[model samples]
Target: MLRIHFAGEDIGRVRIAAGPVPAWEMLLSLHALRGPADHGVFGPWRARTLGVLDASARLLLRLAPPRGYSPDFLTPTADNDIDSLVDAVQSTARRRLRTDLGLLAAQRGPAVWMRPLADGDTTALRCVGTAMFRYHQRVLAPAWDRIHAVVMAERAARVADLLDGGVERMLSRLHPHIRWEAPVLSVTYPVRKELHLGGRGLLLVPSYFCWARPIALRDSGLDPVLVYPANRGLQRLVEPPDTSNGDSLAQLLGATRAAVLQEIGGAEGVTGTDLVRRLRISPASASEHATVLRRAGFIVSHRTANTVWHMPTPLGRAVLERDSGVRAGHGCQRSPARAGFTP
Candidate 1:
């Protein structure tokens, strides 16, 4: 169990990452390669990726074992962009690199190839960066659109929770394995550990590649982040919406109410006031629509101070996802240029 103790100031500091981090995704994808083949969801992706692995990819696999620790230096928090990530790893200070690599070695046995990296050889760092670039382009870039969609959908729900009830409420609903109990957030982990936030707050990062439980940085001294599995619904991402079914749903519920449902799902943490403005409906009408949605279990409304925030429930999101007009957009911004390493 990993227990994270929070302070008073930490309540106001919790944040969710805007999008996926390429460096973190790269390492986590490698770990996914070694996961159980019967997981069903990632089976097809795993087959396709494994067929394309090369020497450079294998070099990374040596350090990021399926079941154990991966050096933290590989994932830099300075920025989330792929280009920045590659640069961060390549330019990592010798001391930090040496320390992280040393920890990796201590956890897993000594590896002869890791010697150069631990010694902070510039060439070895370049090789690491080169591997990351190639692996990302080959493994991640192809399916990025689908991955981005799923993660963004998850983020929207989480952001809504944060807006509705603040950091405490958001933390409580992070995942089944995570429990937020007042001053401490307990997470189920394979090992025992404790982390005191000391008011730096926690960054909640939703990851497509993470499975089972959440993962945290080994070194507690770094900026706190919890990378948890995003709700996949991958098949839904690729399939075309059934407009006929959506139209039927609209008929069953009043057309106006259906529109309200779509609007609630499409918008992140919309309020009754926002609904009134966006839909050009009267305040009472907006409240009525939201109340109906909430009572029917299609949406959840939370009162925050003077305002009440609204978001779709899983069932409501499912209905909206089937509507062609409510298709989710990609969350991660497009990279300015394809990232490359000059090894």
Candidate 2:
């Protein structure tokens, strides 16, 4: 279990990122790509991404294994813009690079190619930056609009939770695996760990690529953040629109539940009372449909005292957009060729 100890003032300092962190998304998506192909949601995305990767993309795979430690310098403090993030990685301080690379070596043994990186060679850093930029342009950039929409939807839900019930309520509802009990917030993790936020608070970053559990920075001294999966937006990132499955949301969720999703998506921070009155349904029926939508990753519910607010997730919004003929098509573009990274 990972336990995060919070100071009294830390609660007030907690924040939810308004959008995705491009660098973190790049790194985390690499990890997802390297994972098992049996993933039902991400399998299609993996296949599409793998078909387009250039040789230099392998450099990133070595640094970020499917499971285990990834170098901290690869992902610096939260930067939403991909260009700025690539710049940050390329301009990483030599001392920081050595420290992070040394840690990676200690855990997974040193690699011949990584030796130059550990020594902070300028050429090595540039190659890494090039690979990152290519991967983003080729793999992530096409789907960025969808990715941003999903992440923002998650942020909207979380922000409503924070405003409705403050830090404790928001923390408590982050995930089923996460638990908030006053001064400490505990999370299910592969390894046992503890983080004490000595009034630095914590940044809650919503990620479309984070798998099942929340991940924290290995170096606790840095500004702390917990990147949690933003309610399974993988299908949006991977799958193409299929008109064959017409009104699929209604078909899968049933008429009433689909209606519930549509109504919730039409507005922001809709309360359960609003559903009851607008839909002309009993409170129990509204609650039941909302529960079904929440469980399906179509919506998130934030409660305030007696009121419960429901907001649509990206998946839900996409479904509605598709039905309404409002969804836009984006084309994939290859990254401009650059000098290759040679060992």
Candidate 3:
């Protein structure tokens, strides 16, 4: 069990990441690749990644295990910028690198390369960084847009929860294994431990490929960060919809409109560009359909910064569910309207 004791000041300081952190995703996905062959959800992606993985890319496996410790320098913080994160890894202090590597070596038994890595060998560190960059290019770059969309959608949902019932409701619903009890938040960890926040608060990062349970940094002295798995429905963001359903729905609603609806149905908080990429439709066409749908009271569109996210209203979900032959209550749950969208 892992317990986090929070102070009054910590409540307002808790934050959710804007998107998936590149380095953390790279590390966790590598761990997932090494695990058992239950790739039913990610089978196509796994196959594609395996085909492109070269000798340099395979070196990342040594840094991350299927189950166990990974060095902290690999994922310095929950920053989402890939370039900055790679630089941080390369610039990790020699003392911290040696200490973190030694801890990993102790747990997994010494690897022959551990000595050089612990000795602050710049070549070894650069080699590891290069491998990480290659793996990201080969495995995650293609799907990053979709991955980010799912993460943002999840963040939007959590934000709604936070608004409706405050921190207690949001924290309790994070995962089935997590519980909020007064000033203490508890998680069922593989090992027994307690973390006193000391008022530094916590950073909540939602990950697309973080399997199963929530993970936290082993080092307590640093800021408290929790990496949790996003909702299971996020998988639909990567998968192509059923052909039969697509054809039937397209026939029911014109091809262009159906395609737009299908994409929005798969993932909420999607932008017009996302639709263009997924459907191979022109931007003008995507905008036209989104306007029509919004005007008809099927979907609601809102702008955050420069991007507009279209979310399916209850009426919209009913239309898709009825057309798809899904029972009314069984369709995707209607997400709450974002702050600016009109009813």
lDDT of each: 0.76, 0.79, 0.75
Q: Candidate 1: what lDDT?
A: 0.76
Q: Residue pairs in steric clash, candidate 2?
A: none
After TM-score superposition, the amount by which residue 241's alpha carbon in candidate 2 deviates from its true location, in angstroms, is 7.1
Error of 2 at 312 (Å): 7.2
Could you give me the TM-score of model 2 versus the true structure?
0.76
Which candidate, 1 or 3, has the higher TM-score?
3
- For residues 37-153, write the lDDT of model 3, one tens digit per residue: 547656556766778888997568887877878888888977777777778888888898888988888889888888887887899888887887888887888777656655665
Q: What residue pairs are clashing in model 1?
A: none
lDDT by residue for model 1 (83-196), tens: 788888889888887888888888887889888988889899999989988888888887665566456657776777788788788888878899989999999999999999
Q: For all the candidates, what are their Cα RMSDs to the real structure?
A: 9.8, 8.9, 11.9
After superposition, which runs of candidate 1 have C-alpha atoms over 4 Å from their true positions?
232-343
TM-score ranking, best first: 2, 3, 1
For candidate 3, list the clashing residue pairs, or say none.
none
Winner of 1 and 2 under TM-score: 2
